[model samples]
Target: MSEEKSPFVVSASWLEDRLDDQNIRIVDAAWYLPAHNRNGRAEYEAGHIRGAVFFDQDEIADKTTGLPHSVPSPEAFAAAVGALGIAETDTIVVYDGPGLFSAPRVWWLFRIMGARKVFVLDGGLDGWKHEGRALVTVQTTPQPATFTPTYNGDAVTSFDAMRAIVDNGSVQIADARGPGRFLGTEAEPRPGMRSGHMPGALNLPAGSFASDGRLKTLAELKTLITEAGIDLDRPIVTSCGSGVTAATITLALHSLGHTDNTLYDGSWSEWGSRSDTPVTTEPTPKKDR
Candidate 1:
């Protein structure tokens, strides 16, 4: 299959003009780490973009896996989104508290689940509010719509698949954890988690792709990515603490027209927890020209 050809990022003004459109769906995919001490659902209940539906990541996940926010099954995904009154044919736009943070995970999920017009709001809620856009505390309940999901097998990488990829050195591993975590110089935010990255994995901290909490332009993203030692031409798989920030890299790469990529669903949260899996605290940095 060829790479996705359309741009998936939209501006706040663009959305404001279509806020009342029936065929469009806005999703609040905001989430926070435990350290942030914020409640995503509660925040959503209080106020969000005028007509957005909240997508709770923790609730709509595969519970069988002893991991956080593992990808949900196709049936579960369809039901979850369908209940939110989101249809497969609607123009879906996802946004988080800060721009380009956790929303890309939702964007990636929608694409894999067969939503063709899914996009991410460029500035997130922060950007929307900055533009003096009005937000209301009132809630909306749309008519429940039916959605059928067709899973794209290539979008996600299993733990076993990650191991094999590491062993084969065919697909490049881009760890979105910060440099300190990747180099074992800083402690992991999640307690009991190990330091360092997967063997042969390169560091591409998710935060670098944005400035002042908004995603950078295409040129800025290209520079940030290339400087981190990733070759856009190579096949890559992105991973992070809990598979959340990994989608940031996935989004950046996709925005750059590099579609030969996949996310490790069971990222470091799963990989670092497994005893049989090999991990190291040392870094052998790859020099990117």
Candidate 2:
């Protein structure tokens, strides 16, 4: 088999070469769950890839929505990112504290918001630091730039659209939550939420796509999805505990050359909480070792 072309991922070495390039914009898109109790901003302030401007997920998100970290409107997103000096034509490299976790969400956000040159830093800051790359502790303020957003509606799945998918089975729903959570054997990290996978959804945890903070090879990603019985050719809507890690699956699918995918923004936070939505605890057997 030939080497697969990566879609949303860029190497640390590639970014290192462009660190001084004027048009290359780097963003520290770090975010953590409330349960983790870790302050993403503090971490980013302490150390981050040189020249990276912090992208606060909470501050940049839809404040009107009650759901956690909901995707902001096209106008809202453009304004927030534009304030960080990112332009539509600039090549964006987003990374987070954890390897592949929160970075992909921002990557997905940029893509949906019509940024053409957005890419996630493979392995994130952890990999960058481990590789002895220079990092900066002092914050750098960037002059705000004007950014225009053209929303790509097809890339996102709204709650109503997900409901239709659940009922009609027109789209494959893949949950990136852990197996225990998917099986309802574990409590949700977020309190007051029900635990169980969406009915007919497949469990493929986000961690399956990374190791040691770096994304696996394309062949490995393809094998992982195929073993999970995910049809790469079919349209898939990836979900997770919230909307965060689901983007990891989206990244993986994109890396495998599967572009026909959408991310369920509300994910289990919306699906599992509703009394009317279908839920299942059926454990799927592991496909391959």
Candidate 3:
């Protein structure tokens, strides 16, 4: 197994060392399911990492799309992030309340928007607090910076592109939803959507990629992907309930040096609702397991 470190993930300790750097920007990208009944912005206002800005998933999304949390256009994203004092050259570290959950989405967003040196903070705020790291309740507001975004279209998958991939099987589609949802045994969290995965998509829950909030080792990650019957060499597109956890797969793939990957921003919300799109309810057959 390869032992390469992903440019997309950084440990809490590593970030702690650079806390005083003026050019380094940290963002708290915490978001929760409606069922969780937690407000991300309110929690951030209560307390967060010192000098960290809050990235609202809903605010920085494609507002025109009815799908939940779709990726915003490069122009919109650049403006939103720029308003938060982030520039193209800043070393960004993003974290969430639930360790590895929402942070990857922000990490993937930065990369897609052509920001270099972007990383997800391992273990998120939970990990930092677990280690007794200092947090501040007083918000720190910085002057907005000029951010120039150069969109990398290849890092994102459009609904039409997904339809083509589904029909042709040219790319591997991986769903990060739970087994029940993936198998259509449970109802989708969102109303009016059917449960089940995209045709030919493999079910690999995003939680499997992390333990105690930190990402698994590269060897373990490779095993997880291979065991799921995914061919690392093939192009891969990851999807999940909305588009948040799907980024966890993208982060894992990036860690393993698989750059030929994209995040389906519409994810299940788009695929499961469209009657013309193919859906699968059958369990993935095990090979004599």
In lDDT terms, which candidate is top? 3
Supply every candidate's count of residue pairs whose N, Cα or C atoms clash at under 3 angstroms.
Answer: 0, 0, 0
lDDT of 1 by residue, 1-289 (tens): 1322227788888899999888999999999987778777788888788889999999999989989999999999999999999988889999998877899999999999999999999888878888899888888786899988889978999998999998888888899988888888888877777778788888899988877566777788887788778888899999999999999999888888999999999998888777778787776477521
Supply the TM-score for candidate 2: 0.94
lDDT of 1 at 228: 75
TM-score, candidate 1, is: 0.94
* Order of the predicted models by lDDT, top scorer first: 3, 1, 2
- 260-282 in candidate 3: lDDT tens per residue? 99989889999899889888898
Report residue 65 deviation for candidate 1 (angstroms): 0.6
Q: What TM-score, computed on C-alpha atoms, does each candidate reach?
A: 0.94, 0.94, 0.95
- Provide the overall lDDT of each model, using Cα atoms, as 2-decimal numbers: 0.87, 0.86, 0.88
C-alpha lDDT of candidate 2 relative to the true structure: 0.86
lDDT per residue (tens digit) for residues 23-114 in model 2: 99999998987766777899988888888999998788887768888999888888988989998878999998767889999999988888
lDDT of 3 at 7: 61
In model 3, where do residues sit more than 4 Å from their true spots? 1-5, 286-289
Candidate 2 stretches greater than 4 Å from native: 1-5, 35-37, 284-289
